[model samples]
Structure formats: structure tokens, C-alpha cells
Target: MTFTLATWNINSVRLREELVCKLMTEEAPDVICLQECKSPVEKIPVERFQALGYTHMVARGQKGYNGVAILSRLPITDAGGRDFVQMGHARHVAARLDNGVTIHNFYIPAGGDEPDREVNEKFGQKLDFLTEMRDLFHADKPQRSILVGDLNIAPREDDVWDHKKLLKVVSHTPIEVEHLVETQGAGGWVDVTRADIPDGRLYSWWSYRAKEWDEADKGRRLDHIWATSDIASAGHGSRVLRAARGWTQPSDHAPVFATFDL
Candidate 1:
């Protein structure tokens, strides 16, 4: 089976429900994993999505806060979720496709303004979350699985607009990068986006803070798509829907896409 998947941090599902519908109506990815849904699972406006043919959903959500959800046109069964670091945030959710492929969607904590864990509690939680993720993947050694979402860390130099300038920044900090790299190594996961579009300044998130986000072009590759080594080679057509950032009442993050043939 061949399926196209997309990962996006929608910021708030209810706030940007129209944007979701627009994406479904236009691009029509087989599966869409959304992070930062910021609504209870029951209030995700599933009827709107179901009307668009994305009838299958597995989600973990909270009121006015972090949430993760997987919506698909293809059949999918809820594979469960995890409360990494016991943060009590609705941050992770998983589903299994009919082809025996599991999809993990995560909305990692944004590790506040200060990168120092000593000064920032959120920073500590973020590190702990990554550590738990690393340990989990190392023990299980995932196979034929894909992980996608706003991981909240841009590990590579080219993943940000100006790597040097952003090194001390939250998403581009060295310690965060190291933790993210360790987690990826643990799972032996392949970055499908980088694999397909190597050697470029690619970004999936442009801060709403920018007055003219497009011309200023200050962005980070916070959103990611990863597949276990076993089926990594089958992933292709990776791209960022950059224009979505300009949509009406848009989310700061854009959708990242990859197609896998299994």
C-alpha cells in the first residue's frame, strides 16, 4: 500500500478548523497528524472532518492546552498514547494502519524562553520527555513505523534560517539538539524529509512574530516526519506546504508531507 502522510502543528483545531478543511479539500493527504490541537477530543469538530472523508481518528486532547490527533481517510485503529515525563499534557497519540504500520504523533513541550533547566521548569520537562522517548525506542527498536509531529527541536544547521544566530534560541539550542539526535539514534529512525530534500535551508515554522514572515524568512524546521529504518527507503515526495503559513488566520507552522510505499 502507498499512502501520503502530513504532520502539522495546527495551534488550535477549533480556531483553525477551516484551514484543516481547506487542506483536506485541496491536498488530500491519506493521513494527517496534528499537534497542539488545544481542544478536548470530543470538541475536535470531527463531524467537519468526517464530512471531508477523514472518518478515522485517534486522539489525546485537553481543554485549552496541548493535544495530538491523527485523522485519516484510510482505516486506522487507536494504538494508544504515552504521557512522557508524566507531564499530564495531551501530547502523544498513536494509531496502526491496516498494513501493520504504526504512526506516532507527538507535540513536544516548547521548553520556555530560557534554555536552562535550572531556571526553567518547562525546559527540564522537555529534556525529560526526550530522554523517555530515547529509552522507549531503544528498548523496542521500532520497525515499519513512522513518527511525525512538531518535535519542537531543529537538530540540523540548515533546518533554521541562521543557525549561528539561533544557536542559543530555544528550538535551536545545542542541548536540545543533542537530546533530539539521541532520541533519533535510539529508534534508528530515518528523517524522511531530509532524506528526500537534502542540502537546503528548509523550514516548517515561521513565527507569527515576524511582521512580514515571508520576506523576513526567519523560520525553524520544528515539524518532522520519521520512519523506522526497515521501511525508510520506501518514503519519498517529502515537502513543506509553505504557502499554508499565509492562509487566513493561519497557524505559525506549516504542514510537512511524505509519501510511503509499503
Candidate 2:
């Protein structure tokens, strides 16, 4: 079986429900994993998405904060979620397709303006969350699985527009990058995005603060897609829907996509 999958930090699924429908109508990926939905599971506007043919969903949500959801045209079974660092945030969820492929969706903490954990409690939480992720995957080891979401860390120099300028910035800091590398290594996950498009300055997130985001192009590859070694070879066609970031009332992040043949 072959399927195309997309991961997006929708920011607020209810507020941008129309944009979600727009992408569903236009791109039509088989599955879409969403982060930061900011709505309780019952209020995700499922009827609207179902009208666009995304009939199956598995999600974890909070009333007006963090949330994660997977909407699919292909059938999938809920695979549960984990609250890393015991933050009790709706940051992770998983689903399994009939093809025996499990998809894990996550919304890692964005650390905060300051990178120093001593002064920023959120920064400390971010580091702790990542550490737990590394330990979980290290103990169990994933197989036939794909992990995707707004991981909130840009691990490569090329992933940011100005690597030197952003090194002190939250997402591109060396400590955060090291933590992300450890998490990926623990799972033996291959970064499907870089594996396919190995060069150039690729970005999925352009800050809303930019006066003209595209023209300024000060962006970072904060979102990601990764697959375990068992099916990493089957993953291909990685790309980011950059234009979506320019849409009316858009999310700072755009959708990242990949296809898998298994």
C-alpha cells in the first residue's frame, strides 16, 4: 500500500478550519496529522472535515490550548498518546493504518524567547520533554512507524535562514539541537525530509512577526517527518507547502508532506 501523509501545526484548528478544508480539497493527502489544535476533541469541527472526505480521526485535545489530531481518508485505529515530562499537555497522539504503519504525532514545547533554562521554566520543560522522548524510544525501539509533527527544534544549520544569527534563538540553539539529535538517534529514525531533499535552505515555518515573510524569508524548518529504519527506504516525495504560510490569516507554520510505499 502507498499513501501520502502531511503534518501541520494548524495553530488553532477551529480558527483555521477553512484553511484546513482548503488544503484537503487542494492537496488531498491520504492522512493529515495536526498539532496545536487548541480545541477540545469534541469541538474540532469534524463535520466540516468529513465533508471534505476526511472521515476518520484520532485525537488528544484541551479546551483552549495544546492539541494533536490525525485526520484520515484511509481507515486508522487509535494508537494512544503520551504526556512526556508529565506536563499534561495535549502534545502527542498516534494512529495505526491497516498497512501496519503507525503514525506518531507530536507538538514539542517551543522553549520560549530565552534559551537559558535557569531563567525560563518553559525552556526547562522543553528540555525535560525531549529527554523523556529519547528515553522512551531508546527503551522500546520503533518499527514500521513514521513520526511527524511540529517538533519545534531546527537541528541543521541549513534548516534556518541565518544559522549564525539564530544559534542563540530558541529553535536553533545548540543544546536544543543536541537533544533533538539524541531523540532521533534513540529511535533509529531517518529524517525523511532531508533524506529526499538533501540540500538547500528548506523551511516550513516563517515567523508571523516578519513584515513580509516570504520576501524576508527568515524562516526555520521547525516541523519534521521521520521513519524507522524498517520502512525508511520506502519514504519519499518530501516537500513543504510554503504558499500556505501566505494564505489569509495563516498559521506561522506550513504543512510538511511525505509519501510511503509499504
Candidate 3:
């Protein structure tokens, strides 16, 4: 079976309902994972998405904060979810496809402006969340699993527009990058996006603060698509739909996509 999957930090799914549907209508990914939904699951406006053939959904949502959801055209069953760091946030969810592939959707904390945990509680929470993920993967290794979401950290130097200039920034800081790499290693996950693209300054998110996000081109690869090494080779054709960021009242992030022939 062949399926295509995409991940995006939708910011507020309710506010961007039209954009979501637009993506579904244009891209038609077999499955799409969304983060930062900022709405209760019941209020997710899934009817429209369902109408687009995304009849299956597995989500964890909160009132106006961190939330994650996986919408699939193919049948899927809820596997589970987690509240990493015990922050009481709806940050994670999982679903199992009929083809036996498991998909994990996560919205890791953005860590705040300050990189120092001692000075910022949010930064500390982000670190703790990543630690828990690493430990969890170590305890229970995953296979035939694909993990996607706005992981919040840009691990590779090339992931940021200017790695050296952003090294001190919260997302590109060495410490945060280390934590993310550790988690990926623990899970034996292959970065499917990088594996396919291989090189270049790739980015999935551009700050809304930018006067002209495209011309300035200051961005980071905060979102990711990862698969367990066992199925890594099956993944290919990874790309970011950069045009989505230019959509009307668009999310700061563009969707990242990968196709897998299983």
C-alpha cells in the first residue's frame, strides 16, 4: 500500500478551518497530522474535513492551547495519547492505520523566549517533555511507527536559516537540539524529510513577526516527519508546501509531506 502523510502546526484549527480544507482539497494527503489546534476536540469542526474524505480522526485537544490531531482518509483507530511533562496539556495523540502503521502526533512546548530553564518555567517544561519522550522510547522501542508534529526544535545546523546567529535562540540552542536528537536516537527514528531532501537550508516555519516572511527568508525547520528505522526506507518524496504559508491569514507554518510505499 502507498500512502502520503503531512504535518503542520495549524496554530488554531478553528480559525484556519478554511485553510485546512483548502489543503485537503489541493494536496489530498492520505493522512495529515495537525498541532496547536487551540480548540476542544468536540469543537474541531471535523465535519468539513470528514466531508473531504478524512473520515477518521484521533485527537487530544484543550480549550485554547496545545492540541494535536490526526485526520486520515484511510481508516484509523485511536492508539493512545500522552500529557508529557505532566503539564496537563493536550500535546500528543496516536492512531493506528488499518495497514498496521502507527502514527504519533505531538506538539512539543515551544520553550519560550528564554533558553535558560532556571529563568523560564516553560523552557524547563520543554526540556522535561523531551526527556520523557526519550525515556519512553527507550523503555518501549517502536516499529512500523511514524512520528510527526511541530517538535519545536531545529536539530540540524542547516535546519535554521542562519545556524550560528540562531544558536542562542530558544529553538536552535544547543541544549534543546541535544534533547531532540537524544529522543530521536532513543526511538531509532529516521528523519524521513532529511533522508529524502538530504541537503539544503530547509524550513517549515517562518515567524509571523517577519514583515515579509518570504523575502526575509528567516525560518526554521520546527516541524518534522520521522519513521522507525525498520520502515525508514519505505519513506520518500519529502517536501514542504511553502506556498501554504502565504495563504490568507495562514498559520506561521507550512505543511511538510512525505510519501511512503509500504
In model 3, the clashing pairs are: none
TM-score of each: 0.99, 0.99, 0.99
79-104, model 3: which lDDT tens digit per residue?
A: 99987888899999999998899999
* Candidate 1 global TM-score: 0.99
Question: How much lDDT does candidate 1 score?
Answer: 0.96
For model 2, residues 193-249, the per-residue Cα lDDT tens digits are 999999999999998789689999999999999999999999999999999999999
Lowest lDDT 10-residue stretch of candidate 2:
207-216
Q: Candidate 2 clashing pairs? A: none
lDDT of 1 by residue, 120-187 (tens): 99999999999999999999999889999999999999999999999999999999999999999999
CA lDDT, candidate 1, residue 129: 96
Worst 10 residues of 3 by lDDT: 82-91
Question: Which residue runs of candidate 3 sit more than 4 Å off their true CA positions?
Answer: none
RMSD (CA, Å), each prediction: 0.5, 0.6, 0.6
Question: Candidate 3 — what's its lDDT?
Answer: 0.96
